[model samples]
Target: MANIIILGAGIGGMSAAYEIRDAIGKEHAITVVGDGPVFNFTPSNPWLAVGWRKPDEIRLNVTEPLESRNIRFVPTRANKVVAEANRLDLVDGSSLNYDYLVITTGPRLAFERVPGSGPEGFTQSVCTGPHAEKAWLSYEEFLKKPGPVVVGALQGASCFGPAYEFAMILDTDLRRRKLRDRVPMTFVTSEPYIGHMGLGGIGDSKGLLESEMRQRHIKWISNARVTSVEQGKINAEQLDEQSAVLKTHELPFSYSMFIPPFAGVDAVQGIEGLTNPGGFILIDEHQCNPTFPNIFAAGVCVAIPPVEVTPVPTGAPKTGLMIESMVTAIANNLRDVLAGKPMKARATWNAMCLADMGDSGFAFIALPQIPPRNVTKAMSGKWVHLAKVAYEKYFLRKMRKGKADPIYETYVMKAFGIDRLKLEENID
Candidate 1:
């Protein structure tokens, strides 16, 4: 029996477990090495910050779900990866050997990049369940006295949707509390414009987002780099089109949330031939490292080039749908390898994101995430918000149910002309 080890217990890794189990069947032994015993729906974190979602509501105990499917679960940090040995060393001084390893360890928060950033600093974050819960507490205390609010993605940050969602959601919550009028809101980002969104403007997103921000009375500072944050104030540099700093501003704020940049986790960072200088795993189109055949990767941990250069640095986002597609491809490829068949199947890196903005939201579809898209469209409405919430509920249920690639999910992809595997790009 082949031993397959999947790293990280987050959405990508868990989904990989379910998909791999279904594809390879009982012949292979699957062991999931998760950083923790629970899985939190990360997309719902912004809702948690606004008190729309509770901590318990979005978390799932991954052990039972995984063990029930005959997958071994370990709740420990993966310290280092010895690629040549095909083994992983855990934080608890234990080791696990595997025939194949799937590295899905999501981004390590780069809070140190900017001094006085993150929750421990003057600003806030919703990157994790605990961080979201802390943000909620901070918001509650701020409700008593509202003032200027700053929310946006920092330089080198890839995930811009959550920053947008948090800013708007916080605005909604303040309005519900009748405090929005007292709070001056601003969106600060490294993107050249309001909705570049790290992907060269996805289907008029700039226009739509700018219009929405204007309607909400929210001002924006684009092409901006936050030098640092201090208590009750934020320091930033607005850049010109030529990527030069145009002006420096010291803006005061009663509250703030900034999405930090992401890098590879410690487990695989700095490993020769496995990761790039930024510590992101280097993989071919098939999501496998060229030097190490048994090593595969997906999600934010994988190295993806920025869509386009801008005045300030910004990284591309790897959406949930794209990660799922990668998992499907990896599972099929591994299954074929074990069955003594030539391995093929490559992931279609398309992205469909539901970006909620309080009562209303936006949805965008981008095929081949980088650019020159086969399909690019965007729509916005309250229906989009409802759909996002529904997706969260459906996904959590799927995780708990231990079911992978449900029929309805297939129909959803077919409607978008997205394939689970790259049929044309399959390797021999």
Candidate 2:
């Protein structure tokens, strides 16, 4: 019997655990190591910040559901990982040994990159549920006396969707309360353009987003590198394609949300041969570490190259669909390895994103998220907003049931011509 250890019980790790449980059954022991007991529906954090979702609504006690599946659950921070010994040091004064390990611990928000950024700093964040709740409190206070608002991403930052979503949602919320006219909003982003979105302008996204921002009366500054943040103010430099500063501005804000750059968590960072310079796990096409064959990774912890170079450094955001596909690849390959069979499965790495714009939304599809792909699409409508809401409910329901990918989700993907795996037969 093989003992499989999966680290980080967030979206990717939980999805991997469910798939592994379904594939390998009860014969093998499955253990999940997580930093905490609750799993937050991260994509809904923007809603949480605007008082649309309560803390309980977006969180699930992870232990109850996983224990029901006959899986071992250890809720503690991982202190260190000894890859060579196949041992994981935990915060609870114990270590777990495993034949195979999967790391899905998400990024460590690099708020320190800018001197006065993040929730603890002058600016606000909606990256996590607690942060979102805090942001909502701040939002409430802001509503009392509306003024200037700034929202955007920092250099070397991925996950631009949430930043964009939060901005629009906040705008909608303020308007609903008849406070839009009292607030002056500005979008300052590391991306070279309004709709670059770290994927180099997905299907005229530049034009579409620019138009939408204009319609919403949200002014923007792109290729902006934020040097520091202060109380009700931000200092930033706008750079050109040549990497020369074209302008510097001191923008004032009553509230702000900046997506900081992400790096591998401290537990696994700086491990020679295990991670890249940025501390993200380096994996082959199969999601297995080339140097540590028994090690695999999924989600934001995995390193993916920037889609294209920008004047201001930007990293591509890995959409949830793509992360789930990575889970499939890693699960299949791990199953093969433990069964003494040749491992051969690759992730589709497709990007299927639904960006909620409060009452309206936008959806984008880029097969093989790295660009130069076979499929590329971007659309917007009220249906997209409704679809996003439905997905949140369906996804949480699936997580509660210890199910991986549901059948209806498959049909939805099929309608979009998306498949999770890149099998040998399916590949050209």
- TM-score versus the correct structure, for each prediction: 0.95, 0.96
lDDT of 1: 0.87
Task: List where candidate 1 sits over 4 angstroms from the true fold.
Answer: 406-428
Best by TM-score: 2
Per residue, candidate 1 scores C-alpha lDDT tens digits across 1-428 of 99999998888898899999999998789999987898998999999998999888999888988888999999999999999999999999999999999999999999999999998898999999999999999988998888899999999999999998888888888889888899999999998998888899888999999999999999999999999899999999999988788999898999999999888898898789999999999998778998898999989999988999888999999887778888888999999888898768888877667788999998877766778876677778997787777778878887788765542253244433445344223211
Q: Which stretches of candidate 2 lie over 4 Å from their true place?
A: 406-411, 414-428
Against the reference, the lDDT scores of all candidates come to 0.87, 0.86
- Best by the lDDT measure: 1
How well does candidate 1 score on lDDT at residue 9? 84
TM-score of 1: 0.95
Root-mean-square deviation of every model: 2.9, 2.2
